[model samples]
Target: MKKSIYAAMLSGIVCPGSGQIWLGKKLLGWGFISVSVVCILVIMDQIISRAQVIAEQILAGNIGNDLTSIYAAVSNVALDASNSTMPALTWIFIVNWGLSVASAFWFGAQQDKQLQLQADSKTEA
Candidate 1:
């Protein structure tokens, strides 16, 4: 059980939400995947929109000698998007992955304990 939990943690580290799948929880696995997808899409949209705006400005000749400043501002916006969303998603992944691993261990330990109790009762009989 410990081994399985550790394996699930490793899987999650490699790919977000894979730990739930490893633990045989398809619904949770899919939920995690969907949330990740939505986050990525939102971040991508922000980045693309900002970039397009910068490009349009450059094409319209508004980016005169201050092109460097314009570039810097656009870069800042991109980084801000990452700063806002990436950390949140990363933390979410870490927490969920850890919970999945712990749950696997707990489930196995409970089953083993129950079996041990049953065996002990039979011996007493």
Candidate 2:
């Protein structure tokens, strides 16, 4: 019982779909991994590129270029990007993360039930 909860929590909170993988749900786990990879790569690349641009803006002394200014600029840019493919990417990320977490917990439950059924069958036999 404790192990099941721990595994589910770990999968949901830490790796998302890892619990499913632990339960031998390889297809779901790998699907999660692939989708997550794409979303994460896009988000990380965006962050790094934006950070570099912010740094350059600071170097160029644009609009005082303080942390607050940088934040505002980032928000504005993200908002602008929302009108493009950025929102789609962001939604993909959101949906994938949510699915991963849900899959982890759900697969954990399914695995536990499967084990219970097998144990009962063996006992009856």
Candidate 3:
């Protein structure tokens, strides 16, 4: 029982659906992993685009002597999305994480119940 809970916690915290996969649900775990990968890619794209823009600004003019200040300037407006994607992406990430945690606890509980039932059956026999 404790082992299952801990397994769920470790995997869920690491990759949300990973706990489910560890518990024997490959498809569910892979789905969660894929969505997470997509989210990471999207976030990385945003960061890279912002970095490119900052690099362009640096090259176009004498905007700074300190690179740190330039980084700060770039970071401030890095979240300016072309559309309403930032909020959606944020929600997707949150929902995925929440789902993962919930699934972990649920699977752990199911495992505990199964073990209890098996032990009871053995005692009766």
Best by TM-score: 3
Candidate lDDT scores, in order, read 0.64, 0.74, 0.76
Q: Clash number for every model?
A: 0, 0, 0
Can you give the lDDT of residue 48 in candidate 1?
85
User: lDDT order of candidates, best first?
Assistant: 3, 2, 1
Candidate 3 yields a Cα-based lDDT of 0.76
For model 1, the run of ten residues with the poorest summed lDDT: 1-10
- Per-candidate TM vs. native? 0.57, 0.72, 0.84
Candidate 2 TM-score to native:
0.72
Clashing pairs in 2: none
Off by over 4 Å in 2: 2-7, 65-72, 81-83
How far is 58's C-alpha from truth in model 2 (Å)?
2.4
For model 3, residues 37-123, the per-residue Cα lDDT tens digits are 898789778768877777777787745748787967776666556657767887898788778777777877788789889999999
RMSD of 1: 5.1
